[model samples]
Target: MSHPHLHQPRCLAGIVIYRPEFEALRGLVVSLSGDVATVAIYANSPISGEQQQALRKAASPAKLVILRPGLNRGLGAAYNALHQLAQADGNAFLLLLDQDSAPRPGMAGALMATYRRLAERGERPAAIGPQPVDLAGEKMQLPAAARQNGEKPLRASFVISSGSLIHLDAMAAIGGFRTDYFIDAIDIEWCLRAGAAGYSIWVDPTVPMPHRLGQGVIRLPLGLLLTDQPPRRLYTYVRNQLAMLRLQHVPVRHKAKFLLSLPVRLAVHLVHHRFSADCTVALVNGLRDGVLVRLGPPDRALIPFWRQGWRSRATTPRNTAAVPAALRQS
Candidate 1:
């Protein structure tokens, strides 16, 4: 893939960090040194003064800005904050990254090139993203449109947040990310809304970024591999997916696909977690809240259950908060 021409608009890269592995975080910052004008490290978790200094040093020649919320504000909130920062700084594009992703050298440039090419052809591309290749060599299934041949950017319904280069102007027109839905499915919700608003989403398959989805891959019969996630993740995933189904902007086919697969997904999660009490409760409550349209951070009622079941096994607490008063009363 070719590098974006120097004449292209400036790009700002925003990386959302939780409790990250320092080495990986440093590597990611170093990799983007010459590619982006500035690197914004948004700390969803608190960062020590020493760690902040270390992060700044990793950004090297590129300007570095730290957005320390000092608490877990969810992925959508972080992205929204990054978008505001980019707009204030007069950047034309915002590149989103998660700490788990390690983009290849020219990945950002390749995405930029695709965005520019699309723009020149009178296409309004809201965002352009690279294909996410699993680090463990698991084959992630792609949409039918994305499987087409050649280097041309393929139209996609949605792309993952990590490794996506978003056009700031388009984002302003589409509105900010949905902080209500919080973390899971934020990217899908935004991308679907963009399409509904007449902006296109593209994926440049030529640019592959090493990304990990969930905890790991669970090998199944007939070569199928399901992403293995914790029970809390399962709860958010189900709730958010169901929330999207209620949105007018989300395509009907997408909703139908999810509905069809919901049972199998729940069964898989149950078996994978050995039908543990916490896992069962998470799935049931997620379904109930989703149907009731109770959306926001994880439900507060479920937090202690998870804490007792698996909190000690995790590095960071699964951030939880009470639902809105209105929703709770309902």
Candidate 2:
């Protein structure tokens, strides 16, 4: 975690946690200790007594600043909270992580070094991220743009939320993450807006971070895809992606890509999953909401949809569950 070139003093590290395993969270925080000036954990889920004690004990050595707002504010809102904290503390960069990501040695240093090199070469990058080495899936998805950058770091459309070292001023200029997105596609939307504001997004393959996408993935003839997420998440993914389709800032190619790929994905989910009917209903509802520009958290109208899915699963004979643990909503 030692950063030899720690000249730029204001690098803050933060993670957004929901219901997480105590040991895993502790390991992640310990990994960040020597690399960052300050570490903040924004817990958006209710913590059990034992879990809280374990987190406190883990933080004692690292001296973490943990903030729990007493409710699940979703990913983008929690990220916005971190952005405000970074801004107020006058930090130059914010290293964002998911609760599960386990940083390897020099992970932060690699990102920071790449940022400095890119800046020296006259590239104003909005953020730089490390290559994600999935713990469960063991697969990595790099943007096509990654292959063209040669020796330098690859310029990409958007990086994953975790293992991303974001430039604070650039994010401030682009108005930060959109809370309306709530969960899915928040990073993509922010990247699109940043690009529209003339900022680049780069990925340094040399710095690989151990991350997990879903709890696990399924092998299909087409490819390896994430297991069936919860119906509510499926709805959010559809709605947010469609919402992106309406934005001018989002690249047309990305919009077209989504238009083509999302249906195939939906078909796959409907085919292999036990909750096919629920997924279909969720997709339809999502499409309707997306078309109407209904943004923000799922309101009371959507609660029945979730309840219906749960009831249907409960009544089933075998009770096959599709949602993965890592992808479960808190």
For all candidates, what are the clash counts?
0, 0
* Candidate 2 structure, TM-score to reference: 0.84
Q: For residues 1-330, what per-residue lDDT tens digits would candidate 1 score against the true structure?
A: 433424567788999988899889989998886677789988766667787677678776667898876567678778877887788888889999999999876667778888988999999999998877888754355565445878777898888899999999999898888776777888988898999999999888778888998898888888767778877778888878986777888888999999998998899889989999778888876776666656667854255444534222212112223322221100
The lDDT values for all models are 0.78, 0.73
Write model 2 residue lDDT over 107-197, tens digit each, in one string.
7767888998999999999999887777753537766554564556888989988989998988778776777767788888888788899
**Which run of 10 residues does model 1 get worst, by summed lDDT?**
321-330
Model 2 scores a C-alpha lDDT of: 0.73
What are the models' TM-scores? 0.87, 0.84
lDDT of 2 at 248: 81
lDDT score, candidate 1? 0.78
Error of 2 at 175 (Å): 0.9
Off by over 4 Å in 1: 1-7, 137-139, 301-330
RMSD of each candidate relative to the true structure: 7.3, 8.4
